[model samples]
Every structure is written in C-alpha cells, then in structure tokens.
Target chain A: MSVPTSTPELLRASVEQFYARHMQLLDDGDAEAWAETFTEDGLFALPGRPEPTRGRAALAEGARRAHTERLASHETHRHWHGMLDIRPQDDGSVHVRCYALVVATPRGGEPRLHRSCVCRDVLVPAGSQWQVRSRRVTRDGF
Target chain B: MSVPTSTPELLRASVEQFYARHMQLLDDGDAEAWAETFTEDGLFALPGRPEPTRGRAALAEGARRAHTERLASHETHRHWHGMLDIRPQDDGSVHVRCYALVVATPRGGEPRLHRSCVCRDVLVPAGSQWQVRSRRVTRDGF
Candidate 1:
C-alpha cells in the first residue's frame, strides 16, 4: 500500500481506526492478528510489572493467556478506548494517550467493568499503515 | 474564536475533544453545561421513546433528572465513546457514529456496565467549535 500524505484529521482518524481494529482482534481472541498490529519488536508495559513484554511472539503469547483465562471464566471482554491525545513527533512517530476501559460479561450475566486504564503508545509508520512501537498501560487507581 | 481551516486530522481531533468535554460535563452532573454542547433546538432520540427530546431546556431537564437519580443511587457514571465513524458533509455539518458505553460505579462498590449503546450525531459549527444539531442513541440489546 502506498503511504498517503496525512493531514492532522486524517492521522487522527487513522490512529482511531488502528485501535478499533487492534482492540477488536484482541477481544475476538485472535491473538496472532492482534499481535501483528505491533512492530516486530514492540514493547508492552503493564502496571506493577518489572519487565515489559517485548516482541510480537511474546505479545501474542500474553494475549493468548488472557484469552484462555477469559474463556475458562466464561466471559467475553470488550476494550473501549476514548479521549485520545495524539502528537506527531519529529522522528516520524506519533504518540497517543487515551483512556481504555475493559468491560467483561459472563455467560448470561450482566456486564461489569474489568479495568479502567490510561494507555500511552508510540506508533511508527510501517509501509502504508502504522504499527505500535511501544505501549505502556497504567491501570486506574493503581 | 476564529474558525480554523480544518484538515481531516484537525477535524477528527476536534470531534474527539468535543466528546471528551461533552461527556465529562454530563458525567459530572453539569446539566446546563452539558446541554449547551447541543444546539438550542437540538433533538435527541433514544430507544423505546416515541417522541424525541427537543430543545436545550428540555434536554437540560432530562440530564438534571438523570443526575438526580444517580446522586440518589450514590453512583457515578462515565460515558466512554469508541470506534467513531466521522463523515464531513458538503454543508459544513459532520455525521459521527460511535459506540458509547456507560460505566457506573457506586460509592464503595465495583464498577459495572450500565449500558452499551450506539450513538449517532450531526454536529454543526457553533462559533469555532462544534455542537450537536441532533443525536440518536440506540441501546445494544434493546
């Protein structure tokens, strides 16, 4: 795909679309596809974790584990992201900060809030699309 | 405020910012302020409601009622919007469709998902910012 010249609105829309697709993949339990949204050596840092999960393989493994847990618990999860602050960097990367809410519903049960988090991500242009270079998620009230 | 020439990226960012402020005002129980985010004669349609809510005064009243109910229930509500599909019209209005999730947390209790809804709005320029000309919300399962 050819890279299009991005205006600020276009870039914002693209980033939002990227997150929509990425989160949906994760929610659908497609760990491999979700992991592919990141760069080959992407870094993911979670709250209270000493070492960040690095690389696509590790990322996929981590997502797989979470998917398994949700399955065993008989729940479906949805990741909702909002209130994005996007900044274009001089190094051809975009920095985004947003609120992410995880909603989980058990079979035949009402939906509940699993987590509220603030997510920070660095996205780099990969071919025509963008890929996550690094992401750090800090849970609310943590 | 001077209206800046909007690129697609700028428009997207502006819309996101609009919702951030709009939803915050509503969640914070600022009914008048939240109602002002809409046009003076804005229309709001909700699921199972035969007639849409019309005008800012009525809108404020509705919001005030919701706030009162929440206060009585000792719960706080946050509206999270995601997966926005925005279209800029030739007439200077924008059409935005998004998923909106309402998460409610009672004092000293865990957060729960109050509602999952799809929201559609037509936003028109009001001064340098945008205001909702009309909005329709449909609950996910209703």
Candidate 2:
C-alpha cells in the first residue's frame, strides 16, 4: 500500500468528491454504480447485523433489497450527506465520517425523513479514484 | 490564528483526547468543567433553535438545565460520543464530526435510548489546548 503523497486539502477534496458521487449513485438507485464506489471486498454493515454485506455484488444487492422494497413504486429516494470529517491515516487509507439523511417523496406527496445515520468509511485510493474498503453505518435510535 | 504545527496524526490524537474529556465531564454532570472546554464566546446550538447559547456563562447554564435536570431528580444520563472524524483546517482550527448517543436509565426502570444526534464542531486552539468555537447538533427526525 502506497502512502498518500497529496496535500491534506487535496486529500480532503478527493474524499468529499467520492462521497458526493456515492450519494448520487445511491439516491439515483443505480446500485451497480454505487457498488463500484467500493472495493471488491468492501463491506457495508449496520448495527446489530451479525455480518456485513461483503463484495461489490453483495453490496448492490443489499441496497436494492433494503431500500427499494420500502420505497413506494411511485416515489424516488433522496439522500443528503454532509458534515464531513476526512482524516488521512498512515497507511494511506482515508477515514470519512458524515451524516446521511435519507428521505422519500412520492410524486405529489410530502417528503419524509426515512433514516438518519452516521456513517464511517475507510477509503483506499485505487488508481486515480478512491474505493471504500469498509463502510459501517449506525442508524439513529430515536 | 496560527496554523496547527502538529501533524495530522498528532492533531487527531489531541482532538480524540479532548472529546473523551468532554464526554466524561458531561456524563459526570460537571457542567462547569464541560463549559470550560469551549471558548469564552463559544456557541452551542441545536436545530430549530432561533439562536445559539453563547458565551461561557450561557453554555454552562444550558448544559445544567438540559442534562442535569434529569441527573438526580428522575434518572441518570449517559452520553456516548464515538465515530469521530477530525479534520485540520487551513486556519489551524479543526472540524469535528461524530455521533452522540444519549441513553436514559430511570432510577429503577430500564435503560432507553433517549436521542441520537450528529454533531459538527469547529475547534480552535486556545493557549495550549483546543476549545470549541461552535457546535451545531442535529437530531434524527426518526
């Protein structure tokens, strides 16, 4: 694993951009593209889950199964990810922390706050882009 | 307004230690000490609040009135802050993102998850230590 040679500001910008792209893919329901945001062995786990969804294929399947089922067929999903704190580690993996607010709205109905969560991600640079090595999400208990 | 002379790793350790102390003081109901963790003009605000509670005096009063209210009269309160992401700013201040879990245990009742929130904080160096410049907490709508 090569160490990050980029300046802190540049590193932060890359992580932020990765997050923006990830959120867009997820909110757009492009599960395949969303999965591409992670490494092949990446895992997405929620609290109380015995095991995380490992591998890109599994990650995509989990997203669709979890959100698409609850989402109204007539509605679209929206996700807001902000309050980012990006830290670069010695091994070159960048740690990311942000809050994600998932909302659903029907064509004419009101938008609803479906889930509010804090997500931590370990992103490893792959070529010119970064891929999530692991993503652990904890939903708000309230 | 000095740039943080410390490296990213060292800065992270400092911020982590600060958060640990902050949580301990708040959980211990040491409002005075907790308030000292902020700058003289520090502001703590929540969503839906018109204005932030500013200044040391006001910050302490708010902490006591909010958390200490349930401390001994009704039940004990515990706050857990975790998943912290610390970022060094250009101006030497640091940006912090973390998840805070508040649990309530009635004198004889079961422990319950009271509230879950995502907090964003801007911490500036004051003398030898870091002080919170501002903190904005957003609660989960769910």
Candidate 3:
C-alpha cells in the first residue's frame, strides 16, 4: 500500500485533465455531460439526515437542481478542485479523492460559498477519457 | 486512464480497510490514533451553510466532543459504510468517497442516527497505515 510519491505524480497530469473536464462541465451548466461522467449504475450520494440516494440518474437530478434552481442567474460560478489521492485499480479504473471549493456570484448577491465537497470517485477509462463510475459528495455538518 | 474493472475492486478493499481502522479509532476512543489518521496539516471539515474549519487539531477536538458530549454512550455505536470509491494521491495517499450510517443504541432510548456522512476523504499511506489528510463531511437537509 506504500507507494512511492512518484507513482502518484505519474498520473497527475492525466488526473488533472480529467478534473479540469469535470469542472468545466459543472461551470458550463452541462448536467448531461456531468451525469455521463459516471457509469450507468454509478452512485451519487449526499450523506446526512435524509440518507444518501444512489444511482447515476438520481445524482444527475441533484446536479440539475444545484446548477439551475440554486444558481439560476449566477453569471459566474467557479469551482476549484485538488486531487488528494488517485489510486490505480486492477480493472484499469482509478479511485480518487478531490477537495473542492465552489464560489457563486449571483448578479447582485455577494460572492458566497455555495458548497464545498470532498469528492470520492471511481473512474473508468471511457474511450480516451476517464469517466466516473460512482461518486459520493460528503457534506459536513448538520 | 483505461484501467480494467478489477482495479476498482482492489481499490475498494484498500479503502474499506482504511475506513475500518478509522471507525475502530472512534469506537475505541483512541484519540491519538484518530488524530494521527490525518496529515500534519490535514483538514477535517464539517461542511455547512457557512464555510468549514480546517486542520487536524480542530478535527480532534470536534471528535472528542462528539464522542463524549454529544452521545450518551459509544457501546452500541455502529458505523456502516457503503458505495466507496478510491483515488490515488500525489503524496502516497488515496482519496475516497463513501456513505456512512452511524446508529447509536443509547441506554433506554430508541436507536438514533448519531451521524450520517457522505465522507470525502484523503488518505495517505504512512509507513504501513493510511492517514487522513482531509475529510469533508457534508450534512443533508430534509
């Protein structure tokens, strides 16, 4: 389990590329692409009092709500992500953890911290891209 | 980028082990180990309406309070984790996403959901053990 730090760096560039693509999809309000990031049976979870819901479609619905309903008029919504870890799987997929900060600027509204998510993701190579198989966004606090 | 399915399975097992150790530390009330699971400058965040606090010491203090003050007993606390995805990190760490359900059976009280988290975690391999560099837990609304 103890890998040389260099190993992670080897995948850094590609991971960053995937991460960038993910961010772009969100920032552009491309829910379809965002949902396509994961596999069909992929789970998108938001854990807390309501309990987490599974499946890609459910996750897509959540994303749609966040992008349109929450920030309908936000001309500028930026999300920054840093991958804390990316592990290669035996099936050629990768498991990754990423830290994120989402800043939303809604016309007259002050720039606010809309959400911060720690993404735990499973990615499979789809064509030349890494697509998500399952993802969980664990929100902190009650 | 084009890894096979087996990769996810291996990564899942590794992540499960990491969570098992983490839950053990909490249930056993092993504060040091619990804290040690984080990096020296790790962020144990509790995401909320407001931004979350960062760093290990803060996380340790929070954990202590939850273990002692928030709950009446830790004897019947059960942590069930599901749907985890693992990611490899730049510094020999792994990023993970999983759903957690903590049900506590207090003495003379109905079992309650003490904590339900969509855990986003970064785990670095320190020697042979995995340590958390960042954990962002987000709470869900009804």
The Cα local distance difference test for each model comes to: 0.86, 0.75, 0.63
Pairs with steric clashes in candidate 1? A8-B9, A9-B8, A9-B9, A9-B10, A10-B8, A10-B9
Compared with the true structure, the alpha-carbon lDDT of candidate 1 equals 0.86
Worst 10 residues of 1 chain A by lDDT: A1-10
Better of 1 and 2 by TM-score: 1
Give the DockQ of candidate 1.
0.22
> Can you write out model 3's per-residue Cα lDDT over A9-35, one digit (the tens) per residue?
435445554665576576557877877
Which one wins by lDDT: 2 or 3?
A: 2
Q: Please give, as one word, the docking class of candidate 3.
A: incorrect
**In model 3 chain A, which range of ten residues has the least summed lDDT?**
A1-10
Tens digits of lDDT, candidate 2, B1-142 = 2334365545655676788898788877788999999999999988778898999999888888877577646887787665555677888888877666677789879876566566889999987688999999966543
lDDT string for model 3 (B1-142, tens) is 2221124334445556668888888866676677777778877667552655456676677668767753555346767554454566555567676555566776767775554456788776666566677778754321
**Runs in model 2 with CA error above 4 Å?**
A1-37, A40-61, A64-142, B1-5
Docking class of 1: incorrect
Chain A TM-score by candidate, in order: 0.96, 0.87, 0.76
**Least accurate stretch of 10 residues (summed lDDT) in model 2 chain B?**
B1-10
- Winner of 1 and 3 under TM-score: 1
